[model samples]
Target: MASTSRLLFASSFSHPSLSITTGSDATRDLWLKNRKVPKEHCSKISMQHNWKHSYKCIDGGSTRDKSRGKFYINATSSQSHESQPQSFWKSTKDIMHTLQKFVMSYYLITMLMSIISSSLLAVENLSDISPKFFVGLLKFIIPITFMYFYAVGINQVTDLEIDKINKPYRPLASGKISYKTGVIFTISCSVMSFGLAWMTRSKPLLWCLILYFAAITCYSINLPLLRWKKSTILTLISNIPSMLLTSNVAPFLHMKTYVLKKTTIFPRPIVFTIAVMSFYYLVIMLLKDIPDIEGDKAAGLQTLSVRLGPKRVFWLCVSLLEMAYGIAVIMGATSPFLWSKFFTVLAHSIMAFVFYYRANSVDPEIKDVSQSFYMFIFQMMT
Candidate 1:
């Protein structure tokens, strides 16, 4: 995780406190000269009793050490030895650290979660809390919390290459979290995510879980393998679950609850607003990838902006609000006088787009700055 974090930092290491590879030719050539296929080389090493080994990060990323023991670049891929030592406190601390790193680094996940939580709180706008919103919170938190952890593990597994090049500081990539350890944490999160969602016993929860699985699988692995990271439609759609999850539970929690004559929970206009709000988040996320374009390209990642050219994507990002607002006004006008919904929708749309456009200068730091601005504005706007 440290290595990956360092790589992430190094991916855009313009900061004075950090040092990372610039993906230069001298480095590549050095790696090639010293390179040996990890699998073939590691299989020959003996993994005996407990002993610590170290690898030096030479200019070419080749391992050398005074001990001269074999080093594994991706130990997870070639895990040998009986098993890693077990300790109750060690395990607990490890998982906690992983979760913390994930939350701290990915502002989008945190922001979306905040929005969802706040929106659900908004559902209480007109009334005190009840079973419906109680259920809604259950529906909202479990799926997302689980997905966040799951995403961290899966993203780490897939991003080993880029991490190696740019972020060699993350714990996992840096040998802080071993392959066995990472797998354990990933599985733990996945199982917990499913179990927690199942506990909710809500249709929305189940559907969201399914959607989350599909999105990660499709975007993180399948589509990338197919090299379709570009194409505005596909890239944008892959992020729907995240957007929807953030907005899904809010409307049901609204203050004005119309009880059907039959006494079952009735539909509210709040639901559509959640969807509209989520769309706004998705647009910013799209713009957030700008800095990563170069690193992603070097790593063979073809995200939408990377494929379409960042400038086009930037303008396209600016246009999304017009498109979204147009859709919202058309649909709302055709319907009833849900004036509150329209204004809320318009307000969030403008706020999200305006902040996102201003924040879309460059990626990495600029994106972080943009995200910070967006979060601040979103809080104020909401």
Candidate 2:
């Protein structure tokens, strides 16, 4: 009987849920009395060992089968551990999705345009390609990137309802990001952009940012006697200046006056670029509305697409872009440099042909087709 009691105690002590505590002889005697273990066996056991033990439930709570002397660990803890990484990845995916909606392809295109325009101007100014040029270019790009995001964000915030109808997948429209969050994001971007431009101490860059901000404000903000986008003429007025600033004039002046440390002058290439881009941007401005005609009409926004039928506006935009390409081809053909002449003429001719092909294939009545063509136009600009 003593041997059987000792074996029982050993097994109980070795159980996962049981913990042992060492104690004095009196405490061991008390434990032996309570457990009814034989005194002989208790005496044989080491005096330093105390049989007093307690069962501990693993975290997240546990259940024990007293009849079977079994403990079941809670699955909640293991499940939580497994879900942590998944939860983190899900959150990351959500953030990226929201960013994609906020900073669409157009904003990226804007940044690319700014970088290309600035880099070209830098190349013209500097005798050698150096780190300083890249550094300055980066500085310019940082502010422009923030500003472009701000422009798109603010527009989305203001046009949330319209986007719901026209672009349901957008963050604001889809409820991925709240209106208040979008407003805060745009405000933050605007502050960062202005702060960076101010820190640069470049008057041209500062002015350019300011002008772009004002143009977008007039184009988007719904104030009394404002909202330039409501009227086609007012929309063009706002867009033309913004386009010139974004694609040509502002970048050129900023690079000349700030990065190159030279007097501002519009060279022949700058003027030609401005003219070409102006025409291209004009086409974009008109074409972009075609896909959003349904929403615009519902919102009582008389865009060219809403006023004049989508077909007419579509053809007009195509014709205008074709004209711009034709002019570009002529300009390229007349270039003084043989290489420039050959490449420019060849590139424009090919682009013009591709644009014609793509335009003919698009059915403006289909929103997806019109939207694809709109993106195609932006791709051509880049």
Candidate 3:
């Protein structure tokens, strides 16, 4: 009831007597904050992103999606409608479209399937995989949705540096969207992420969202702190908790008693999966550092490449990826059942190395190879 009241009171369309143009910038920003946040309906992700953008007075719009981006404006029947980036009226109407674009671009549904399915199959090896679409949708949405907003917020916030250097076309830094608007929208999306997750009642998914949000927060901090080394480990290490929680606990979590005790559902395999996925995810995360070395150095990021020099980072990526291969070999040699999966993992691990290795000399090419390798690995998991 409070949320409904706040929404009604905060809405400009509800009272055409209120002129948006007459409002002060502070008033406008506040209204927007209220419209979005609205007496704390902002939910879980709100806190994660709000800290970065609430007071931000930085620089950057909306053309299309987009693959991400931000926009702001109030709506009404008058000039507010006509003057909005589109019609102010459409601004409100288009929100659904904006959300749709966000969901589609991030492949939210598919991603939920990626982790949840893999965990289900690998653990239960379930022959009858009749996924509850609603549940799958919830699980699928947890990670990708969080990632999509965080990426936008992080890009917008951190874009201050990138714009002055290379990307002057970004929304926040380029002036397409105000720092405040971008931040608010990002927070709203984050809130929506958790709000919707809660609706699904999937504790594992909720925990994954919380942890992933934290990792991204850490990513933003690392960018400024020059904890490049720690960031590398974090990029990979953080996934450990999620891997254990989701893959191990989720499937077997007697959806009945699941409500009673979620944490006590631990098993040894989860610990092992946690360590393995962390190592693999870490390798992928660090692979990105190689290409960004120069930009990182210039921005004072002190990334692994800048800290260890480019050659060392390259060898390190190779060495780390190869270690995955070695581990696979050992699994195959010993546990035949695990080895079967190991073969699948080993092939992709080596392929990831080949992609990284071939692109070692070039920077831009690295992301494509790495992404392709990610796709390859995901396919194997499927």
Q: Best TM-score goes to which candidate? A: 2
Residue 293 lDDT, candidate 1, scale 0-100: 64
TM match of model 1 to true structure: 0.55
Root-mean-square deviation (CA) per prediction: 18.2, 10.5, 19.6
Collision pairs in model 2: none
Which residue pairs of candidate 3 clash?
59-172, 60-171, 60-172, 60-175, 60-176, 60-177, 61-176, 81-88, 112-140
lDDT of 3 by residue, 1-382 (tens): 5534434344423332322223246653564465454434322111111222332111111011112322222334455555766766677766666444422432233345544543443333243334443355445445445655655575556546654454454555556566777677777777877777777666656676676667556655445653223444554555444444444344444231233332344444444444555555555555556555545666766556556765566566566656765665455455546656667566756765665666454433354444454444344333
- Arrange candidates, best lDDT first: 2, 1, 3
lDDT of 2 by residue, 18-39 (tens): 2233556576567456545565
lDDT of model 3, residue 200: 66
Q: Can you give the lDDT of residue 202 in candidate 2?
A: 73
User: For candidate 1, lDDT tens digit of each residue in 1-382?
Assistant: 4533443333242212212324444553444345442432332222221135322333122233324634323333123232444455678887888656643454444445554554444443445456764555555566666666776677776666666654566766777767777668777887888887677555555666677766765655544343224444666676655555534442233222321112224344455555566656666667656645656778766677677776676666556755666666556555666775677567656765665666465343454443454454345424
> Residue 178 in candidate 1 has what lDDT?
74
